[model samples]
Each structure stands twice: as structure tokens, then as C-alpha cells.
Target: MKAFDQLYQKHYPTVFRVAVKMLGDSDEAADVVQEVFLTLFQTMEKGMVVEYPLSWLYRTTLNKCIDKQKYNGRFQKLETAPEGQVEFQSIEKQETRIRVQRALGKLKPVERALAVMYSESLSYKEMAEATGIRFSSVGKTLSRTLKKLEAELKNKKYELY
Candidate 1:
């Protein structure tokens, strides 16, 4: 219990961020994060040791987000802001973020997951382990996925600066 709490404290924010990046809605992301932690808790209760908990968490979160996206249809447009808070980002920055997210949405689920993992600065090894891609293919696959994302952005006239 103590160990699980500590792990949750350490990793919850990362999992949630990944979920939001993948799912586009904070509410949906929060639900997915809850589901991931619940799965972990159940696994622990079953006396199964997750050798790499962070990797396991990432894998599970990404998988859940992909499944949710499939079940819900296309990735929904993210709300510009939460109610009642002044939007502080420069207009250019906000536009860039929205453009990039739209490009990300154009990718297949696995490709989007790879791109998100890359954005998170995950290593090829970590990405492979988390996404179940072959270690040798992670770099190649990510390179192609990134090119695909770039093409999607360019098609939308969203230059990457």
C-alpha cells in the first residue's frame, strides 16, 4: 500500500500528461489515468510483480487512450481553455499548439502513440518496451512516424518552426 501510494505520487502526473496528449480531453484523460492505476492495483493484489512499473504504466495508459479513441471516433478538439481563466499564451504559441495537435490527430493510433512518446523524450529502448515494438525497429518506426506527422502538418500549412 505504501509502495503503491509512492509510485502513484511519482508517476501520476506523467501518466495524466501522456493521456491528455493522446486523448485530447482532460476529462477523458483523467478517466484513463484512473483506469490505469486501478489495473495496477488489481495486478498488485493478485501478487503479480510488474518488473518495470513505469513502462507498464506508460504502456497501459497509451493502450487505453488508443482504445478510447477507437470507441469514441476521431479525437475531439481540445477546449481552448478551462472556464473563467484568462488565456495567457501568445496567440502564435496557441495557434502552433493547436496545429500540432491537429497533425497528431491525423496519425494512426500507434503512430500517434510513438509521436507522443518521442515528445515525452522517451528513449528508443523505453518506447520499444512500452509500445511492444521491436527494439531494433523503434528508431526506424519513429523516424517514419515523425515524417508522416510533418507531412500532415505541412499539408495543413502549419510550418514547424
Candidate 2:
């Protein structure tokens, strides 16, 4: 329990962020994060060794978010988590985030997660370990996802520049 506390404290924010990036809704992201932690707790209670704890958490979070997204039957418009009283540096920054998220919403859930992590600059090796994607495919998949996202944005006149 003590160790779980420390682990949750360290990783919860990352899980929550990934969930939001994948699902585009803070409300749903919160639920997915809770589900991930609950699963972790249960798995640990069964004495399972988490080979790579962070990777496990990320993969689990992505799985739960995909499940939730499927259950909801539709995508929600992306919005900031609204973690009470947080301020954006500028309206331009906020708009950019929103536009990118809108483009992301058009992707399949796995692609959205990969694309978001790519935008965050995670290495292909890290993404592969976390998501169980082939390390070699990560680059090709990301390139395709990004090109698709770019085309979608272009249709909406939201230039990445």
C-alpha cells in the first residue's frame, strides 16, 4: 500500500495526461486513470511483478481509455482538463492545442495515442515498449498518422505552421 501510494503519486499525472490526449475529455480521462490505478492495485495484490511499471501503467491507461471511448460510442470535443484555476499562457497557444486535438479526434484511438506521444517527443523505443507496437513500425505508423492528421487539418484550414 505504501509503495502503491508512492507509485501513484509519481505516475498518476502522466497517466491522466495520456488519457486526456487520447480521449480528448478530462472527465473520461479521470475515469480511465482511476481504472488504471485500480487495475494496478489489484494486479499487485495478486503478487504480479510489473516488469516495467511505467510502461505497464501507460499501456493500461491506453487500453482503458480505448475501452471507455468505445463504450461512449462517440468522440468528445477536446478540451483542457480544467484543473481548477489553471491559466493558459496565451489564447494562441490554447487555440493551437484545441486545433491539434480536433485533428487528433479524427484518428483511431491507437493512432491518436501514438500521435500524441509523438507530439510530446517520446522516443519510438519508449512508445513501442509502452504500447506493444513493433519498434520498427513506430516510425512508419507515426509518419502515416501525422500525414493523415496534416491532411485533416488542411481540410479545416488549420495549418501546422
Candidate 3:
């Protein structure tokens, strides 16, 4: 119990950020967080030791986000960073966020998860562990997913510059 609380305190922000990026809605992201913690608690109660709890959290969060998106059938409207988490950005930054969100919506859920992982600066090894992709394939898959996202943004006249 104490250990789980500590773990949640340390990792909650990271998990929430990933969920927000994947789901594009803080409310939905909050729901994902709740589900994630519940799963973790249940697993612990069953005496199943998670070899790598951070990886498990990331993997679970990504999977839950994918499930929520599939169930909802569309990405919710994009907004600036979650309230109080980030200071207000300039209009250009906000617009860019919106464009990126829309472009991300076009990606398959796995690709979107890969992109979020990449953006978080997670190493290829960590990404592969969290995403269950072959380690050697992480770089190639991420490159392709990024290219696809760039193409989507460009098609909408959102220049990379």
C-alpha cells in the first residue's frame, strides 16, 4: 500500500502526460489514469511482481488510451496543455498544438503511442519494452510514424517550419 502510493506519486505525472498526448482530452486522460492505477493495484494484490513497474505503467497507459480511443471512435477536441500543468502558450504555439493533435488523430493508435513515446525522449529500448515492438524495429517504426505525421501536417498546410 505504501509502496504503491509512492510509485503512483512518482509516476503519475508521466503517465498522465502520455495519456493526454494519446487521447487529446484531459478528462479522458484522467479516466485512463484511474483505470491504470486500478489495474496496477489489482496486479499487486494478486502477488504478481512487476519486473519493471515503470514499463508496465507506460505499457498499460498506452493500451488503455488505445482502447478508449477505439471505444470513443474519434479523438476528442484538442486543447492547450492541461490546466495548471503548463503556462499559457502564445497563439502560434496553441495553433501548432491543435494541428499536431489533428494530425496525430490520423495515425493508427500504435503509431500515435510511438510518437508520444518518442516525444517524451524515451530511448528505443524503453519504447520497445513499453510498446512490445522488437527493439531493432523501434527506430524504423518510429521514423515511419513520424514521417506519416509530418505528411499529415503538411497536407493541412501546417508547415514544419
- For residues 1-161, could you state the per-residue lDDT of candidate 2 as single tens digits? 88789899999988888888888777778888998999999988898878788888888888787788788776764534345423745767666666777788788887888887786678899889767789999999989988999987776553544
The residue-level lDDT of candidate 1 at 56 comes to 97
Ten residues in sequence with the least summed lDDT for candidate 3: 77-86
TM-score of each: 0.89, 0.84, 0.88
Off by over 4 Å in 3: 76-87, 158-161
What's the true lDDT of residue 82 in model 2? 41
Candidate 2 Cα misplacement greater than 4 A, ranges: 79-89, 158-161
How much does each candidate deviate from the true structure in C-alpha RMSD? 2.6, 3.0, 2.9
Candidate no. 3 TM-score? 0.88
Quick one: RMSD of model 3?
2.9
* Candidate 1 residue pairs in backbone clash: none
Weakest 10 consecutive residues of candidate 2 by summed lDDT? 77-86
List clash counts for every candidate, in order. 0, 0, 0
Ranking by lDDT: 3, 1, 2
After TM-score superposition, the amount by which residue 133's alpha carbon in candidate 1 deviates from its true location, in angstroms, is: 1.6
